[model samples]
Target chain A: MTSNDKIIEIEVLRYRPEQDEKPFLQSFKVPFTDDQSVLQGVQYIKDYLDGSLSFRWSCRMAICGSCGMMINGVPKLSCKTFLREYYPGKITLEALKHFPIEKDLIIDLSDFINKLESIKPYIIPAAPRTLEQGEYLQTPRQLDRIAQFSSCINCMLCYAACPQYGLKPDYLGPAAITLLHRYNEDNRDAAKAERMQLLNAHEGVWGCTLVGYCSDVCPKDVDPAAAINRNKLNSTMDYFLRFVAPRGGN
Target chain B: MSKRSNEPIVWSLFGAGGVVVAHTMPVLIFVTGIAVPLGLVSADVLAYERLAGLADGWFGKLFLLVIISLPLWQSAHRIFLSLHDFGITGGETFFRVVFYGAALWGTLLPLFLLVGM
Candidate 1:
């Protein structure tokens, strides 16, 4: 073997409902180079070792937002996490926290998906214009309001990082709420009133304790905590101002 | 289907209290606790008669009420949420009643004291 070949133990949490009743750890000795990522290590195991192993990944690049897993109990994208960092030692890979394990490394994202869909993630324009009316122009300042929030890639790493979401699954989570703020801040969007209705609930931004772990774990630097807090301020204003002008003022 | 939460009422108090405490509490602390005792400023600044005179005005009474009461609300809200964060959920209503109810009492008592002055 060449000196460049570095062998490391990769322990993956395996769960197959058909054969195994419970999830258990399975370790593989993976030989990798310094440039190989943790995802590549798992790919090596699948290609050369156990083909039955299951996981989800696409666009080996970090932008796909897939391949998020719990590495040493921290949420990270396997594509971005290098196995060389954990070389000469064993690394454990498990399904992302706060999510149900569908298979080995594949997690059930349906709950997060449902919550994302509930937030009306698409833009609802304040005033509709036909194609003949040309594009809606916006100043840089207008873009700046929502720009930071618009970077969320829906990786759900923030969800795994959020203790509030783990405790209260019904809570409208970080990414979805950040996306809501994105649309609300868009100058072309006029659905702030409708969006405010969703945000004015107990399960909305109020549910967030501002642990800020979500922001810390976000790969895209999307500060969902800030988005939620800002909306908290908005919801507070709406709550009190409802007494003054009950209807469309929001 | 959107549901409205009454958390805004308490949250507003918390926000206002946060602002009041952050902005003015340090100055109050330095002026009353440190400067007054150290004689860094004039003793007449907090003399009994001078304080009484300030309290006699409606605006001064209002200011005192806001300064004293809002911080209480803020602390109560923070404590209440912190309890929830710590996985203590059985006494939710009880804690709310005790914490916020105490703040309410604190607020009322100060108003009564300030107005009587």
Candidate 2:
């Protein structure tokens, strides 16, 4: 909006399924201030330069977890990434890597959604109780166990950064497993045995060779890599214990 | 989707091996290769007669077995997974057999060598 504002080039990867056989890079130059984010730059292109540009973003403050994309080959939330950091150099924007692009900047997240559902991301009560039985109280120490993992907003950035998930799509990738562990760590939850069966599989935590990039790309500081590795110890114990006591577990 | 895998059996071995390699191998290397040669430890501490005597003992044989065998499993698992990371998808069963078979051989060879002494 200022006369002294500088113009920057944003090279966006475009793919219209009905129009193009493959994705291609298209550039747009837009004037912007130093404080503006990459999301604003894309919005400018949509509002002023081209109306057909497609992307998903709901919360501009980074909490809604919808505006994630590949910014210069790294997974990042557009709303949290500043364009001024790359002012002189042009920036490349692509859909999250390792996922099929549905449109220009949107990716097909149906696989991620399905995995999220399979984890049963809810507290299965250790014992059923009526409303009059009162609230399930947890000490701060008990809360600390799963609090860090609960920060995941389902952004799927970890999946984009994971080499295992890229190689094996059925590997039950990071965010879902982190969420799964969050519920399993709850004191009131008795579903650890049931969830352990899913985690004990070949494609579960073992699929992760501990490449550890999932934790690096997490904007929310949710260390899915730690969650997966911790569960590996539990899974290992379960694997041996099953031979001795087939019907016994937490 | 919830079918169990035999990976835990191997992974536990790999994990234990990794711990031994990480925690003990350096100390072992330094003590034998540098400490004795540099006289930080007396040359007589690792004398050939003493080392042979160690190899002849049951406990020392167990220690040598653990030190030699576990690291083999660790290195093999690492290599097996590294190959997969490099996008080598074909002949997976063949690769597993060869790599793990080599590790098993390494383990057994040490056990026999130490016990036979």
Candidate 3:
């Protein structure tokens, strides 16, 4: 174990909306402990060394889902990634990929939220259930089918890895679509037909070029790429079988 | 151009074809082709006895034909997609050509083998 007195070489992406026209990288050396996270290292610079540097974070423990950034060219939550991983080496920190820089590490995630809204992101039953019957029943196997898809904390790491979303802004990126699937698979939810109508659009599942990076970068192993791909298969089958079975979208 | 990932259609076809080629063609040579009949003796019996038994009869021929043809079509389809991802845009006609070619020969092989003189 090395002392915390050592300075770690950090090259961070810097952008000033009020000053600079575009984003660029700036290097700084900050002394940090092995126990400290990259977020702590950034805080050290912001608090003592350079107040001009800006990034977003809260909870400092990785739960807030607010501190995702491109660390060493990979999108990760700064609060979770250990500084010891890059000890004695130069690391380049940048804003999350695929979104325009709002300032330093901040990105315009408004578009992402809008896509989230597009899916309705809630349960809508085909018919209202009576109070006597209680909630819809689902088996463990059914839950397993979509439970792994539900662990996403919306860190947007998957979006940063998806080249398809970067190339096409209109494409509904991984995180939001994964949320859509969360509700779509719920047995208590009867809106598969309605949801499928929205999800089958161009900006929906079809927009995915299947770059597969979304699954790779996902911290929760939600496999949004697989979700979208499987949904595509389902939607296509449902559409083709529509004539044979008039109510087949679900 | 954007890179496509391990979509099942592309990968499964490619993989199954590679496996079949590695496992099947060599057996055909020692057991039935110019090697076995001419006593070239350049093959393994235990390595292929079970598989050879299956391929000896009509049912086996049918199974082999189905497996081999499907993988070829799949490989062709995957290769086309791989080409598209690499930004080699020769147009959709290339796909149509493969489709029609697959349609033409994909069925013809079974028809030829099953109903041959």
Best by DockQ: 2
Residue-level lDDT of model 1, residues A81-146, one tens digit each, is: 999898788999999999999899999999989988888888788678899999988999999999
* Backbone steric clashes in candidate 3, count: 0
Docking class of 1: medium
Order of candidate numbers by TM-score, starting with the best: 2, 1, 3
Ranking by lDDT: 2, 1, 3
DockQ preference between candidates 2 and 3, better one: 2
Better of 1 and 3 by lDDT: 1
What C-alpha lDDT do the candidate models reach, one value each?
0.90, 0.92, 0.75
Which of the predicted structures, 2 or 3, would earn the higher TM-score when compared with the native? Answer: 2
| Weakest 10 consecutive residues of candidate 1 chain B by summed lDDT | B82-91
Superposed Cα RMSD, model 2: 1.5
Query: In lDDT terms, which candidate is top?
Result: 2
Q: After superposition, how far is residue A146 of candidate 2 from its true place, in Å?
A: 0.3
In terms of lDDT, model 3 sits at 0.75
Name the regions of candidate 3 deviating beyond 4 angstroms: A1-4, A129-141, B1-65, B83-117
Q: All models, DockQ values? A: 0.68, 0.82, 0.11
TM-score to true structure, per model: 0.91, 0.96, 0.76
- Candidate 2 regions off by >4 Å? B36-39
